[model samples]
Target: MLTTLTDYRLWALPRNYVKIADAMIQEILDSGAVFEDIADAPVEYVESRGDLDVIFHELRGTKGCNVQACYDPYIDPPAIFVHLSGNTGRDNFSVLHELAHHQQRVGDAWADVTEDITDRAFIKELREKVANSFASRLLLHEDLIDSAFGSGPVTAAGVRWLFDNSAASMQACLYRSLELEGNRVVMQADSDGRLFFSAANSDELFPPHKDKTQEEIARSFDRLQASADGSLVVRGGYGIQHLSGKSYTNVVLDMVLCDGCVLVIATKGRSEQFAFSDDGEYYQGSVCHDSFLIKDSPGRCSTCNEPKCSKCKSCGCPDKQPPPCTRCFMLLSVNDVRAGLTAHEYC
Candidate 1:
């Protein structure tokens, strides 16, 4: 499904449908449909628009139906035929993705593309991409994303917050919340250590993730077994092995076990430690200036710019012992020591 740049040579790229999707959501909200109301019954909510009729059927063996859901523009009133996949999040997304197709037909958005120059497969891929984009926006908007995540990087709690707040799938929430940086990756794996999918930021320099779960992932599953409170999340640091025979150590990982799958967010190129203050705010304890998540941490050394440890009062600087004075031939006090001088300051 990964399409290269050359494939899009003759076809116009998909337009940004985020605004249109957001507008449609606004219209739905203005019609007195709250999120909770639409969440359980997305098809019902969309069907009420009178633009498209929803039909449920077993899509397999049906002529011309290959996807979980598809929109038929030729049909009078334009019907969206859906096969319930049992996964609520995915089913909802399929509905919305097909709805995007409905919009394309009504607006005649495909007219600008030169379809004859490209094969049908390329066109289908392009349209699918467009529809997926539209569906993602419809399920989760930017405003909601910011409100859920705040200023911190994507965390398990943030992912859970979005899941409870919106009707988007866990996969969609993870995809939408990701920061397009090369130093991070998000993965979904089953309980038995089988990877469903993995997504990395724009940096191709990062090595490919393993097809199956690594040792650390297995350890995480073991840790999850001790959750007496029934908590499904396990967050910690573990080395991740890349496919290139190299391993990134101490990668920050946040994992959540839900819907028979484990969702993981791994951050590389940084080490994070939580240090709390008396004011009830926590900061990233950067012992060696490796972490970039530092926030208002007190006791930063003016010389090294590293935070001084609360207990040791050390700022990652090496200890310097005063040398003996050449003239006195004795150990000198730190304050009295003068470097490269024959005598101390007092002398």
Candidate 2:
């Protein structure tokens, strides 16, 4: 099966760009340069590949440019100007993103995609997405992600772990986590509840233009318990009523606060069956009777050995049907007949 990362790249980037990016990554790996440790010296590694000039500039308020970095292939030997954000992870991403542009310029692949695209805005956006795909792949290699998170469910703690442990930026980890679990939305918002970034793999769209902030999402971070690595985490369902009058009711939010931003990993709300602790070490199951959360009993399926919720008795398998009622001669659901009963209780 194709990994979520592969699927995302195919969707976000042009085919030629993907091939070029993969080839570049493979070249780096073939050089015996530890690919997983690329974050440690990204600038050095990028510079080693070719003759490129690096410049640090304050790019704020620059007309026609709003990004933190840009590649200028017009200069002698080409130059990549980066505006440092002081955050190592984010800064490294900016550098790699610009380097990807440099590669595109050198390979002359720009001609391949630009001919048919008459819309300047679309061309610019496509180029940026292509560059982002390359940078994200370089920083968060598939192998590294697989090693960090094996085929387990993506959790808020897992997202926090990837950001805290790897060289990838928080946004990169959020995007990767979304790819891993395509049904959820991974969003980043300020402490004041203003949303700046969000990505979703689900059909339910986020509010158009991504500028609106709901106070409820921001307020949800209050009094959240902090884990060992200083990420504040909390889990609950909330009504995602955007300020623009668009609303989605009963969305499950798995939130974490780190580096002054609330990262909300959300899915469509469902009955609370099980919940993981802030560190993901403890699992709490809920009973159907009261939907009360219970602790310390991690039940398993007898046949498949798959873990089940001890209270609700839910596992990887589908709901089991009770034997048919002898009188009615119909397969019985749990509600109509009790287990091991050949006849309905009423019968």
Candidate 3:
């Protein structure tokens, strides 16, 4: 459905790049090409199936190049050389990316050019982007992603599902899902906390942090620590201050350490009115109102002083330890965090 970059402007990619990517995907779909699962396929196996030779050689110091994969289309049947030294996920992605180039009829011409050196860099960048797009489409089919999100909200679990089911990396899965489910942001930061790359549906909602130093950004998010399981949600004053900017509010963040880097996903909460039931019971009456409210109000129950009455102060229920208010700073599930409220009333 997203035919143009404008339809999915969150990526902030060049219009021409999007145009080419769109055409490539459309052509693949039109030709009824079945995207086979290559997640477990070896590099040699993949190359063989694609009718290409596979070779592994040291390319680290060659031509000042440290690329993980390269496709030499000048050969009779073409060849894809994958750097076995690279990470498995990265190597797999690179192979698919090169295969995409082959599928799109993009070959060594872009690489073999000697004139217009300035333009060569730009052309190479464009071609790389197109190849990445193609690889993403091939590995993570549109239909599979649609089906995953069709059941419910696109939570951290859903992203993990896509990652497990596809040949893409966690970062790739996050970025792809952002395109599929607009209005979200994904950022990758180094272990030292320096932001390396970020992608979003809207810059206004999630601006670039490239200008800030690693320490500055880390301090903004309370010293940004990486979680092994990717379940950490930084909240409270530190999280709120850093996440909520001039154009955003009710921002929720989940971070995980991936290959010595931190991957963060921030979702801007939609403001929804919540009211207490007539009975004044917090759990029973705490319902999200369909109508939207511009400004958050404490509501009638929030200010009610009916005494504890042996009930939990948090939830207004007869219990021992009070449950934290959903409106306030609390560790919530991925789904709840994604559906965070800008305002809420507690009985």
Number of the top TM-score candidate: 2
lDDT of 1 by residue, 1-347 (tens): 11232334322222332333444455446757676545556788778878789888784332333348878778788988888888777778888777767766654334334234345654555566556666666677666778777766776667667777777888777766553223456777766656776765422113236574555666677565566622343333334555544344435667766666666677643223423234523222222112222243446677655555443343433353344443332334443443455445664
Badly placed stretches (over 4 Å) of model 3 are 1-33, 37-46, 49-51, 60-67, 106-124, 143-148, 189-197, 206-250, 256-262, 269-347
lDDT of 1: 0.55
Off by over 4 Å in 1: 1-40, 61-67, 108-123, 179-183, 204-210, 225-250, 271-347
Evaluated against the true structure, the overall lDDT of model 3 is: 0.49
Candidate 3 C-alpha lDDT tens digits along 1-347: 33333322122253334445656655654555434534356365455465677777666322222237777778977877777754666677777677667655743333333123344444555567666665665566666687657756666556666776666776667656665645566776765556766666532233345543333235433343433454455432122122223122345565655555666666654213222233422221112111112222234233332222222122122222222233332222223334563223442
Q: Which ten residues in a row have the lowest lDDT in candidate 3?
A: 283-292
Residue-level lDDT of model 2, residues 134-253, one tens digit each, is 677777777767766779767666777788777878987786675563467677888776787777653332422377675666666555433544354333433454444544433567
- The TM-score that candidate 3 achieves is 0.54
The models' CA-based lDDT, in order, is 0.55, 0.58, 0.49
Looking at model 2, residue 67 earns an lDDT score of 47
Q: Sort the predicted structures by lDDT, highest score first.
A: 2, 1, 3
Show pairs that collide, candidate 3. 10-201, 277-285
TM-score of 2: 0.63
TM-score of each: 0.58, 0.63, 0.54
Ranking by TM-score: 2, 1, 3
Worst 10 residues of 2 by lDDT: 284-293
All predictions: root-mean-square deviation over Cα? 17.6, 14.1, 14.9
